[model samples]
Target chain A: MSLGEFDLIARHFTRPARRSPLGVGDDCALIAPAPGMQLAVSSDMLVEGRHFLSTVAPERLGHKALAVNLSDLAACGAKPLAYTLALALPRADDTFLAGLARGLHALADRHDLDLVGGDTTAGPLNLCLTIFGEVPTGAALLRSGARPGDELWVSHPLGEDEPGWLGDARLALEVFRGTPGLRVPGEAFDHLRLAMECPEPRVALGLALRGVASSAIDVSDGLLGDLQHVLRRSGPDGRPLGVVLDADALPRSPLMRAQTAALQHECLLAGGDDYELLFTAAPADHGAVRAAGQRSATGVRCIGRITAESGTTVHDRHGHRVATPWASFDHFRS
Target chain B: MSLGEFDLIARHFTRPARRSPLGVGDDCALIAPAPGMQLAVSSDMLVEGRHFLSTVAPERLGHKALAVNLSDLAACGAKPLAYTLALALPRADDTFLAGLARGLHALADRHDLDLVGGDTTAGPLNLCLTIFGEVPTGAALLRSGARPGDELWVSHPLGEDEPGWLGDARLALEVFRGTPGLRVPGEAFDHLRLAMECPEPRVALGLALRGVASSAIDVSDGLLGDLQHVLRRSGPDGRPLGVVLDADALPRSPLMRAQTAALQHECLLAGGDDYELLFTAAPADHGAVRAAGQRSATGVRCIGRITAESGTTVHDRHGHRVATPWASFDHFRS
Candidate 1:
């Protein structure tokens, strides 16, 4: 016997919130936004195996789902208010669901976001969370507001690290087969193994960029790939736009650089799953922007500039043109 | 090759909303509520083969997801404002996503809900939508405010045709056996068939019930089952509650009565998925309440009264006590 849907919701999901005038078990949760404030809303989904390893802890999965949605609101400079979670679990497990809810509530409580209303059902392991916040009108950042003269920037270091991890596959497979004493390079593990597992979402940096940055987007795709989105959107009504990247300005560890050179450096330019913020700000506001960057303890790099050239172009240290391949993830590539 | 997640979203969901200052493709969407108002938020999820038949059109699935969430806001007397959708599709089919987006947009436009930020992912079929609205503070209804003397009422009639349509165990096996020329009664078939498909969310009726109705909950589960939720919440300092139903006052069509009788008369009391509004109103507002109900054209029926007793008790036509099964799609019971 398993816990039914209604009981699961009652026991695990629908707990009364401290600040909520009306919380779970109601038709809708009611909140009074500060007068003269506008609400910001965003939704995101996390699918098992697609978004996370099946071996990942259920509690971590719940936390990530809510964390990612909250990060979206943070990117708009909105203070989180409430959220509703729609969970599709394979079956009813009281222990797993309780732990998941606990993790969700822990993060939500820290941010003052009340758990409002949502649905729970039996299905594959999928989590979709919709969150709400309030920001003063006309202040939230948008991706279409970047001007041609704006300086393109990123809140965290850009560049991918996949090829370095898969180095000498033949030798490594043979070593694992029988040679227990084979030594693996520590630098290789950091560039490859760590990068693939947990990608930190830059919540504080995104919120800090709101006032100064003219436009922004979360970097789920690679830097060059995602910037293409901002450039295309910020252009004059869907026209192509040019963005020039200073290859040297991209932050890279010594180990990463060596690994990239050995691997033809293509992976560094195109690998995905880095959940940082790519944005643009006015040249005059660069000092304040740089000051805000120090507060987050993450280096803000001026990587490029929005230009009217109508397409992306990368440059080497000598200012010569560099060829860049499509560096975004293709879900269905043979 | 199938379109990747980002491309799929760009192709089908990134349309410019007429009222949204910034729509999809943003970190977060801004919604400006009318001055001097509070915000209301609600969410719902629809999974294939569970909430609906596998054959239901994708377009209808999109509409129903938003509609159901909007109905929640309506129940709180909140006017529609904006919504964010999170959709997971098994494959990247442009036409299917387009039809689904069109359906969502059509209903949203009618209700003045601006499409805002959303995420698209590749996974099992599930659509989770969160809708936001604004209403006057202190006017939203809650389920904890019902008094013992308050009259229990429901919008529209009871008795869905799901049981008759799903057929008895014998009939279900017959259908699987390919019984040639076997026929279910047409009226029963129509009722249950309708039950198996679309459900009309009573948005307007719910909004009208606010202020007058002390407490409310949507009739997602059957009438008696949902009423138990109200009773559990409205009791004194966390005490169990009792409710008494007036059999004669339960509104149902003649066909519904026959259908229920055919299934041991439980369908009227235990059938779920009827998206009606179950509420409790003060006796003082009876006249105006009835007038409002007439205006909505959904018809309001006063069926019972909340009591301080510990458990539920139903009376038959001759006042005999009858045992009622407490199970209706119990999520814990597989």
Candidate 2:
């Protein structure tokens, strides 16, 4: 059925949390941070063809748009408060927009974030989700605080599912689409589908590491590339960090281990869109981090340590130099 | 020459901003407000065909995108501080991006705002500008405070250049191409061009009216239509407001008067994108408002007054009912 903008908003965006004192349907949303908190704001843009494949589902696209930005706030140890979504969609199709908004609303509700003010207009699919979070002043983490002697840790092992790991193409498709090619249960397939389509923002893990972590950033442009950014942005007092990934320390699901195995390390190092936290902290905080990880049930791995030299080096299990990290998806690539 | 997104960002988006604590290269911008001030944040989106013609000057489109969002902060009586622009363009042409950046930079410099952080992605042309401003808590004006018996005022002449309005195909083409048809002296054309391309943000006027105005909103949609929003958002204890427009009391320019003879009165009531403040104040503040207007050298006229009524009514010069207002340009209209 045809849908107008307001109808889509009503159907998919109507939520009780939106009754926030400063919520959707206003010229500008009014916000008041709790006393002693500083507001952290971040914006991200997802463009059709560039940021996502056209074959991807619209709901997944919406979820990823907000997920990435929320991940940014999570990196700063901030709690998500509200977000403004500027959507430029190609057509006024009810089915497509509703699915997209449903994904966004579900994510917002999961995080307890109120959808605030934003704008919608006609264009090729482009979503800019601007999110605001609140962190106590002087406590928000930054990428500039990595100390020369600090240990560099990743929230989870990098490269979970390599291209070569997922079994035969047809079998994998059957598993992904909930059909029983190998007799995988429907509930298991559903769980896998949820894992592939929607990712929970690492809010609890981020907040838990707040005072202990010295520097942090979410791994969006793959582990190696994003670590390069953290290294590059380290302040004058901080030092460049070399991340040494123990090939055997990498984490993986049973399904991820079953597929093709050639060049699996290279693929995991180069592939992007893994929104895990990569952070640096003092050696003393390691005990606290390990204890907290036990309580939270979230993965925490120490991959390397900060260095005085200004470069990134990823060593193999045998401690040999590996291929340099390639650039992640660049929209203006020729 | 083809450009990669990283190079585009380094070349065009990495300019040092005097006001930003941490600038464009960071994950999130850090801006500390002047002590004790609350931040005002607003966002607006401009789609290629919806907001302007594709042939419209890229520079003007950039300026208008940021200017329109700044107007929202002005409506709330906040001082412009910084902005993040998320642009989705079809291609990464250096010339187009540079011109757009220059237009945005020029206006931002005039207002002393920093172009902080944003995302750039490839898609159909769409520009989303999210701006931030600061006002002391409890001092920011809102759209919900209008009361019965308050006087309605607007910041500029009721009718802008009707014939030369941006939508007129001939005028828009001439302005874009720098053709001399319907030309005035260079300085006058500069003013006209500024009006057409980058209208100034009314931050100062908005700030001055902080305590005086009961309610305010920037006139982006036509005057009557936007005013209806202010009325509809009236707070629970606020008296019902009735606005009566005295066609004679509207602020007018010499050119506007000459053009009014040909362009009907409806143009005055319905023409959009004035980017001027339309606000209400208690009748007791009228004299003070007149004095404030005189000192600032800007138009602030008493166009109407609020009354204890449920709906609004407009009058002709001879007190006849005006036809109902039409909807502003709908982006989804085919």
Best by DockQ: 1
lDDT of each: 0.67, 0.68
For residue B122, what is the lDDT in candidate 2? 70
Name model 1 segments beyond 4 Å from true: A1-19, A157-197, A262-268, A327-334, B1-15, B157-184, B187-192, B260-264, B327-334
Sum up the clashes in candidate 2: 3
Candidate 1 has a DockQ of 0.56
The local lDDT score (0 to 100) that residue B191 gets in candidate 1 is: 47
lDDT of 1 at B192: 44
Q: Cα miss at B5, model 2 (Å)?
A: 2.6
Classify candidate 1 by CAPRI docking class. medium
What TM-score, to 2 decimal places, does chain A of model 2 have?
Answer: 0.81
The sequence of per-residue lDDT tens digits that candidate 2 reaches over residues B135-199 is 88778788888887889998863246422232222233344667543333444444455555556
Candidate with top TM-score is 1
